[model samples]
Target: MNVLSRLWTIAAERRNELVSGVSRKTNAVEAVEDLAAQLKDVDAAVVLIFASPHFDKDKLADALTQNFGATPVIGCTTAGEITPLGYETGTLTGVAFPRLHFRFSSRLITNLSRFSIDDGLRFCREFVSDFGETPGWNSLAILLTDGMCRQEEALLSAMEPGLAPIPILGGSAGDGLDFKQTFVLHEGKFHSDAALLTLLATNFRFTELRFDHFLPTEQRMVVTDADPGRRLVREINAEPAAVEYARAVGCSVDELSPFVFATRPTLVRVGGKYHVRAIQKVEPDDGLSFLCAIDEGLVMTVGQAQDIVAHLDREFTGLKAKHGQPTLVLGFDCMLRRLESELLKKYNAVSELLRQNRVIGFSTYGEQYHGMHVNQTFVGVAFFDPENEEETGGEREK
Candidate 1:
């Protein structure tokens, strides 16, 4: 099999340039060095990395920082990587954006449990100080944190007031379902129990993308008992959470496993749209642990699967109609989607959709769109440059 593949790139004449590359080389240094070679002339403003957990993260971070220290280098470990061709494992993929069209700044947030609004405000202020206030510029914040922290809700909430006007888009890092350790890069070092914030301010047109393939059903259960801090639901409608959930999905309590949870996820309505609140596991107490935050009194409904390909196609179609042509799309996909596709025997079809759309990212533990931290969803940023645009814009960005 061809491990190293060609990059999917887009250029906006003299304004901005984006080039994405993937490397299957076993050595982290060689992999990144090979990927870096693809960008020759342009001085990158930021380099976004999505890498497998197989590498010594410190070495990878050090190597990438040494090579691209002048720019902001940020990324996180992933459950699985999305490349130009399709879904992959054990690979490091990245994209470099030229400085002319993009300006980048970042902060490494440590001790996620103690992450505060003050800290968020400080980070926002720092970003403003770097970029200055621009009236017509578009901005987005890329947030990556340890998947096991369970602090997304608190951290994201704190970040809201400070990051007004600049939307948030990102995902929680994963250790390939090992659930042991996950790493995020800041400058030239890798840190755990932390999060990295990358602020992107650009003159080019950018569209924020968030979509899912689950429709709510009539069945509903109220969270009578839950531990919001631990994201554990002890009871649903006053019954054992797993038991009630299994019954709703037409399965026995014993069959309430990861595969089942992925195939038949639960949804919670947020902002009038149903966002999936996926179950991570059936706890020892028969309680249900979720990938995202859940609270008592919250109503959860079972979700039915939609035609995954069709939903994706529709979203992409709409994007092209509006953006002209996407220069690059940085995606954050939930790992559960991969599992669900496998259960439905549509893994190939789903991978094809990612390739067809030139979506490069990783399957994450969870995703963030705007200010909301969610699960089983795909969130991304689609960039467009008018000067060298594609006339027949397909939904896929670079």
Candidate 2:
């Protein structure tokens, strides 16, 4: 290729790169406008947004549709936002995937309360049929669900078989700490009892990442009485659930709050791996309400907090060493982790590390990985440059 021609190609590639932007504007239209202006230069195939629950959902949806024109858009309300500048609140953040390296297809599942495993399987099968495949490109699926739907476990389990070999990962939408309504956006509208699933094909080297800074301790308790449907534990070790948990954590029942739950999470072992079954709040009946499923006669252990900053640094460093610095890290961090960080006074340090590592997304009510709906964990996908001939060849073979 001639020197001038090569220069032109490089410039074109740079303009079509993956891009992210953030806007703290409180008005929905202004926030959308700000984000649209920042992304106007790229030929975006799709744009994913993460906005605070405080915004007017209807106005935000309309503005997004009007500003982005024909580009597809999808996202959800967040407990908090992880922008390029790091952790933020009351803001709208987004990432634009350029058409030069990516393609997308989306499906919206509504009425989650009645969604069954069979329904999820059929839904995924149809989605995959429509998505088809692209040779020499890697594929991944992202699932965003209404956090309050309480159906993530069943939905994820069902979708797993159909999306096998595609590596699905995602998070449940949050309404901050209110634990009230949560919505997922699709087709220029926000629906509370719905989920948005997207399949993305990218000509970029990428990897899935999942981690949490907690270790299962020996302290154990048994759920002797529970309401599985509502995820309520009325009794533990045959005693009042909240009282027993407080005793286990060396605190009083009255002092049991979100921060305490964040610092001392409950874990369950599945497939030889411990996953956090986070507590949402203490119920009026003194039962312990959970963010995930609970069952009678289930054994649970308390988890001890580790050094989050150190653990995060190690994980990000290892990612860089293996992938040679990702262009962007699409992250789904659990809100409990954020609460724990604030309690430990390590929020700034963690935010700085996120900024340095190019992480962007939102703090979720829960996270999904490999068909499991988990809590108190950070789940993400890291996208690296595909320019290296060796790396491109390696990805194609996979």
Candidate 3:
């Protein structure tokens, strides 16, 4: 007998304020392990894991790999992780699933440098096409890349011209260890300098995402001098690159540092509209660099239109209206965005809302949408029936 999403069971726990403004949690494994222990027993899945700076890569990977070996894991390092139990600080929180009825597929490219745009479009087209064949299928792309890679825009650009109107979402991955390296986990392996793409298909209806959180607050600056990647190693809008960036965020070059670059990144408008190509690093010669493709002559502005909180509130409210309370939430929140959130006064209120809502996701360096990588964004999918049936909030249990 089909279960009407049936005989539902749940597993959830939270440890609040553990470390680095992070919280930890694990379900299925902790509470529902007895029910969903066999990987083959499950149909659809979700996972949440956290690693602290206190632990090194090997230990963190080994521990997580031990508990969540069979699941296709997609998450980024975070200042903290949120769960129904509360927030987990400086801990590795993991949740697993072995029984659920739905559809999902995950694929990865080991090295994007060798992978071409053709390969990307082919993958997205193929994945989405397959999901379309499923009954009641709604699609989303959960993409993760080595945060250091600056290929998101080019990659998305390459795929867009050919694919149907597919809205991609997900984030750049990070190693909980540091901002320097990011990783993705699949089949018990922790990948460094790689990208993971998860295509989800469920009967659940979703939201129509419009990019916001930033506006052209300042005049566009032309990058007169630059390198091959189009980095402005000399000036922006006719001023030292550092000056424009520091000026926008309200700081001084002497006081400006790499840490500043991470938390307060700038965006360059590419291909007519402003795509989120954030300044990933600053040069010693006083130039700025990016994590995605940028070309000289590209006019960039210190972007500032809306705060993320306002943008997100609008997005979430829209989702709630479209599908009511979500059945499942898979969030890719940028790690840098998490830091900016902490610096902002509303961080506590924001995390609490997610906690109360029972959202399970990891912090990322950047995010993925449809089939492309993006930064300073929150990419997610909320499950619900289009008709607003019985409002089965219990499916969110474990």
Candidate of highest TM-score: 2
Per-residue CA lDDT of candidate 2, range 1-398, in tens?
Answer: 99999998876765678999999999999999999998887789999999999999999999999999999989999999999999999999999998878889998998898998887898898888889887778889999999998898888888889888788899999999898999999999999899899999988888899999889998999999998889999999999999999999999998998788998989999899999999998999889999998999899999998899999999999888877888899999999888988988999999999999999999999999978999999999998878763432225222
| lDDT, candidates in the order shown | 0.82, 0.91, 0.55
Q: After TM-score superposition, what is the CA distance of residue 387 in candidate 3 from its true location, in Å? A: 4.5
For model 3, residues 1-398, the per-residue Cα lDDT tens digits are 35543343311111111111222323322322321242223332655344433445554555445644555544445545544443344555444432233456676667865667887777767866665645444455556666656566556665554345545666665555355666666655567666776655444455534354766655556776666445345677667777776877788878776456545556665447665666756678778766555566876666663665676677677677655776446566666566666666657666766665456666666665654555666666554433443331222211
Off by over 4 Å in 1: 1-16, 387-398
Pairs that clash in candidate 1: none
Error of 3 at 307 (Å): 5.3
Off by over 4 Å in 2: 1-11, 389-398
> How well is each residue in 240-332 modelled by candidate 1, as lDDT tens digits?
998899899998998777778876789999889999999988899899889898999999899988877788878888888866667677899
Q: Is candidate 1 or candidate 3 better by lDDT?
A: 1
* Backbone clashes, candidate 2: 0
The residue-level lDDT of candidate 2 at 44 comes to: 91
TM-score of candidate 1 against the unseen true structure: 0.91
**Model 3 global lDDT (CA atoms, 0 to 1):** 0.55
Model 1 weakest 10-residue run by lDDT: 389-398
In model 2, the Cα lDDT at residue 20 comes to: 96
